[model samples]
Target: MDKIIYAILISNDRQDELTRLLSGIRGISDSNLFNITYNDISVVASDFSSNKIIVDKEFAIDYARVIEDLAQHFTLLPVRFGTLMESPDAINEILIKYYDEFKQNLQKVENKYEFSLKVLWDYEKCSGKIRLKTESEDQNAAKLFHNNSVSTEYLLKKIKEHRFESALLEHVEQLIGEISTRLAQLNPIHKFQKMVTPNIILDAVFLLEKHKKDEFIQAIDHLKSQHDDLNFLLTGPWPPYNFVEITLK
Candidate 1:
């Protein structure tokens, strides 16, 4: 059978114990979950019938769940949702090929975990409030209504709308900047996605020291004080999903 690789884990040469533990779990489609170990690292996997296609989201999430279970007992590098190999030998070859890179990555993330932070806001509410703040400037522009021709009025309205949009964008950037400054103090290695949309203003992931979990939370709470307009959604001390650095063919 073909195989789908889920993650790479640190085993410290304990392949026998790792195998014993893996024997109890099931992978996708009720297939057996297994591993491809080399020295102190192993790639967790499952039987994947190459011809029987199942690329749906529910199955993919099930795949993630399998990795999540193993991660509870080991530090691992999670592969992107669908990473398949032809056989155990192939995975073993991959382990050797990427051994140094994997070791370095493991070293970098040792005794640490990942956390995600997202901030959502009420689109209409925030936009309306922002419009009110800049309305004075807009009102002045509106009062400069010179030519009463249809095209002239349309152009003026368009200009006013563009100005309001620029104002909204600037306000959002300021919020992101403030959050970034606060997170920087936490000294975390992170990847941040900001201004994804008007409603989803920030989506960030932090690779933080395990012991600093509380400090990270405290930082968020303190940061929240300055922005009452946005909603903060923070998830994870997740197993380094965004921090993994190696790949398998």
Candidate 2:
């Protein structure tokens, strides 16, 4: 049977505790969950047959549930969904080979949780506001194009599109800057993706201390109050999903 791995965890002194935890949780398809320990590290896994298991949404959710449960009790690096090894020996060898990297990543996210924030706006309304501010800049653009004797309807149209994109990007950056300043006191590690779509202006994730979860939420609420035109959707206190950076081929 293949072992479907869920997470790589720091076992250390929690060996017995981890055992009890796994005993109560069910792996995908309700398979019995078990630990394969290698020194201070461990892999959470279950017996699985890749050919028999239907690799679909429900299966993936069940797999994630196991990892999520374990993460609540342990500091772990979540193995990507669908990870499997042919045998216990194969898992142990990989654990031994990547022990240091695993340990380092586990330590980095020891007491932190990942949180995501998506900021959305009414695109048409926001665009109208931006257009008002850009009318002067558009005139300057037209003047420059005219001076070059390169003015054409298509060229001006392209310039307007470019200007709108630039303006929108600048707006998102300013918003990100304000958000960073507001959260700087909390000192969480964060990442941002701006302008994912016209309506979805910013998508951000923060790896925050578990103890500060409430503070983070309140901070976001205050930010929301400050920006009535934008909507904020915040989710998590999740397993450090966005913070892990390891690849074992």
Candidate 3:
């Protein structure tokens, strides 16, 4: 039977306590949970038949639940779902090989959690507003080239389209800058994606100290109040999923 790896955590010489905790929580397929240790770090795992696994919503949820439960008690690096080792010896070898990398990551995430924020707006309405502003500020290109040939008219249309796109991108960038500036006080490690969808203008994740969770939420609320035209959806205090950068071999 293969062992399904859930997370790597700092045991800190608490093996007996960890064993008691794992005894109360079940792994996928109700398998017993156990840990394979290397010095002060450990990998929480369970016996699993690789062939018996089914990739489905239920399985994914169960897997996440296990990690979430462990996270409440320990600082852990969540292994990718479905990670399996052929035997305990192989698992031990991995723990040995990646020990330094694992320790570094674990220390970085200790006492921290992650949060996500999505800024959304009505794309059509926002674009229309920008178009109106652009046209009002500059003479209509179609009117300026009314007497020109068809080729000239097409070129003018393209130019207008380009200007509109540029303006929209500038607007999004300004918003991102403002968000970063406002949240800088919290000193979170953050990642931002612009224009995740037509409506979702910004998608961001932040790794913050656990003690700062409330202040972070308050900061987001303050930002939301300032942007009446934008919708801010902020979630979490979850395990530092986005902050983990290690790739296990």
Clashes of each: 0, 0, 0
Overall lDDT per candidate, in order of appearance: 0.85, 0.89, 0.90
Candidate number of the best lDDT? 3
Instruction: Encode model 1's per-residue lDDT on 1-249: one tens digit a residue.
Output: 788988888999677878888888888888888877788898898888857866898798788888888877888888888887888999898899989999899888888879999998888998998889877887778667776889878987888898889998898889889998988997899998877876898899999989899999989988888778778988887888888866444
Prediction RMSDs, each to the true structure? 2.5, 1.7, 1.8
Q: Which stretches of candidate 2 lie over 4 Å from their true place?
A: 145-151
The sequence of per-residue lDDT tens digits that candidate 3 reaches over residues 107-214 is 999999989999999999998999887775446666666577888878887878888888999998998899899999999999999998989999999999999999
2 Cα displacement, candidate 1 (Å): 0.2
Per-candidate TM equals 0.87, 0.94, 0.94
**Model 2 lDDT per residue over 50-101, tens place:** 7788999999889888888998889999988888899999999999999999
State model 2's lDDT: 0.89
User: TM-score for model 2?
Assistant: 0.94
